[model samples]
Target: MTSPYNNKENITDKSSDVVWHNATVTSEQRAEQKKQKPVVLWFTGLSGSGKSTVANAVEAKLMALGKHSYLLDGDNVRHGLNKDLGFSDADRIENIRRIGEVAKLFVDSGSIVLTAFISPFISDRQQVRDLLEHDQFLEVFIDTPLEVCESRDPKGLYKKARSGEIKNFTGISSDYEAPLNPEIHVKTAEFSIEQCAEQIVDALIERKYFSF
Candidate 1:
């Protein structure tokens, strides 16, 4: 996909006067203080596939274990940071790009950032993964069949999409590109929300992101 934000000339022109300033208090120091490894838990799937549900649960679990964390839900971000963006493919790409940048900053600040977004395009998700170190980025795919998602339709989005009231809705109008090698995959259709959240917490523990 072509990204208006990726224009090399535009980027160079915009960044020409900017200088990098190294902070004395580094990410490592911040993480050490927090007693947890900073990382980004990116949840991707169709809307109503339980991304936010599972993410909120996982964040609660992390907090109970004394891990510093933050959650950036798609709808919440749209209310502020990404309100100017839209549902077009280009706008979606820009949205993910901006979120990826913000998540990186959160990681740098020593917080395990949990992002709940549809992030339908594999290329867009991959772009976000490339923003962080390999171990710092964990793709959590909430795998629910479209039929199940449509049936759940918590926000009435699927119904709207089916009726043509919504355009470019993922899984209905837009294509949802499944992750090829996600670090964790939760089949939400088969698992309870608590179970899915616990599974992610276990994965984080196994990966040594934090200790309980």
Candidate 2:
């Protein structure tokens, strides 16, 4: 399928005669009803960088505060929605492109969507950011050293990648372009998971994304 969004990775030509649909209610109205802003917390990092762990914890914190939120994890999404894709550069671009569209939908529904994806390429992540409003996308870099991520290897994929069993594996065979200036940068190697999560959640509150 072709991407409707203006992106460089459009594999197929845009379809003809597909009209855009306007929602009856505005995004501001939806977010006002939820008492928070519709935002996408895009978490980018290397494998085993604690992206999922930190995102899950932040989601829990949002729940406790009664905020509407959802998390789209990389592995979880690959299990189904993007099952057909691979780790090739082209496929990876397509992966984030599809995710950006999905996250835009969640934002329109007035929910804070947290996405956990290695998303190694800078352009791919920037494409996702372009899909949202100017202030709606917050890039959170889960900064962890290569050695630290490999050592933590929650999944054995890292070990396999090191052994030449897997190709195009981020941080092992593939390159991970770290964020130059992310909205929030958390060094997972230096902080506990709880501390990292709190730092993110607190940043949201301080930015007035949500208030008591």
Per-prediction TM-score: 0.94, 0.93
lDDT of each: 0.94, 0.94
lDDT of 1 at 65: 89
Candidate 1 overall lDDT versus native: 0.94
* Residue-level lDDT tens digits of model 1 in 1-212: 96856588888898998999999999999999999999999999999899999999999999898889999999999999999899999999999999999999999999999999999999999999899998999999999999998898889988999899999999888999999999999999998999999999999999999885
For model 2, how does the per-residue alpha-carbon lDDT over 1-212 read when each residue is reduced to its tens digit? Answer: 75445454452344444568898999889999999998999999999999999999999999999999999999999999999899999999989999999999999999999999999999999999998889899999999999999998998989999899999999888999999999999999999999999999999999999998
- Name the top TM-score candidate: 1
